[model samples]
Target: MYGYEITQKVKAETNGNLILKEGALYPVLHKLEAQGWLTVEAERVDGRLRKYYKITEAGDKERVNLLQSLQEYLKTMEQLFQPKWSY
Candidate 1:
């Protein structure tokens, strides 16, 4: 998806808790493109040029790895936060 679409989707998915501004979004997109994790395609939409980004195989692999790490971290945090009972 394009930058604006991505921002809107993330906002909606997160119930408006997350907002991605252009200043932050574009740089990340550019970096991913440079790293070959994402591919960009430019097209004209309503007389305006728009760039759409697609995830590459490597990007998907990285995403899965990151998600697994996040899940493990969250689980550890949950365990740490659990109340302990003393007899």
Candidate 2:
């Protein structure tokens, strides 16, 4: 999806808890493209140029790895925050 669409989708998926700014979006998009994690395609829509990004296989692998790491971190946090006594 295009940058704006991606941002909107993420915000919606998170129930408005997360908001992304264009300033950060563009740079991150560019970096992902450079890292071969994303493929950028340009198309002219309504007389304006728009770039769409698709994740590559490598990106999928990385995403899974990151998700696993995050889950572990959350588990650790839960343990740390658990009550000492069951009241």
Candidate 3:
């Protein structure tokens, strides 16, 4: 999707829990695009030019790796926070 649409969809899905300011989003987009994780293209939409992003094959692998690492981190945190003995 185009940039604004991408931001809107993320905000809607997160229910306002996470908001991406352009300051944060665009740089990441560009960085991912630079890292061969995303293919960026420009198109004319609604009488204006917009850039869209499509995740590349590398991005899929990276996403899986990142999610796995995040899950492991969360599990460690849960174990650390669990009750050590009867209260």
Highest-scoring model, TM-score: 3
Q: How would the candidate models be sorted by lDDT, starting from the highest?
A: 1, 2, 3
- In terms of TM-score, which candidate is stronger, 1 or 3? 3
**Model 1 lDDT per residue over 1-87, tens place:** 999999999999999999988899999999999999999999999999999999999999998999999999988987999755555
* Candidates' RMSD to native: 3.6, 2.6, 3.0
Model 2 misplacement above 4 A: 83-87
TM-score of structure candidate 1: 0.86
lDDT top scorer: 1
Segments of candidate 1 deviating more than 4 angstroms:
83-87
Cα lDDT of model 3 by residue, 11-70, tens digit: 999998988788888898889999999998888878988888999999999999999999
TM-score for candidate 3, residues paired by index:
0.88
lDDT of each: 0.94, 0.93, 0.89
Instruction: State model 3's lDDT.
Output: 0.89
Give the distance in Å from residue 72's predicted Cα in candidate 1 to where it truly belongs. 0.7
lDDT of 2 by residue, 1-87 (tens): 999999999899999999998899999999989999999899999999998999999999999999999999988988999855565
lDDT of 1: 0.94
Clashes of 1: 0
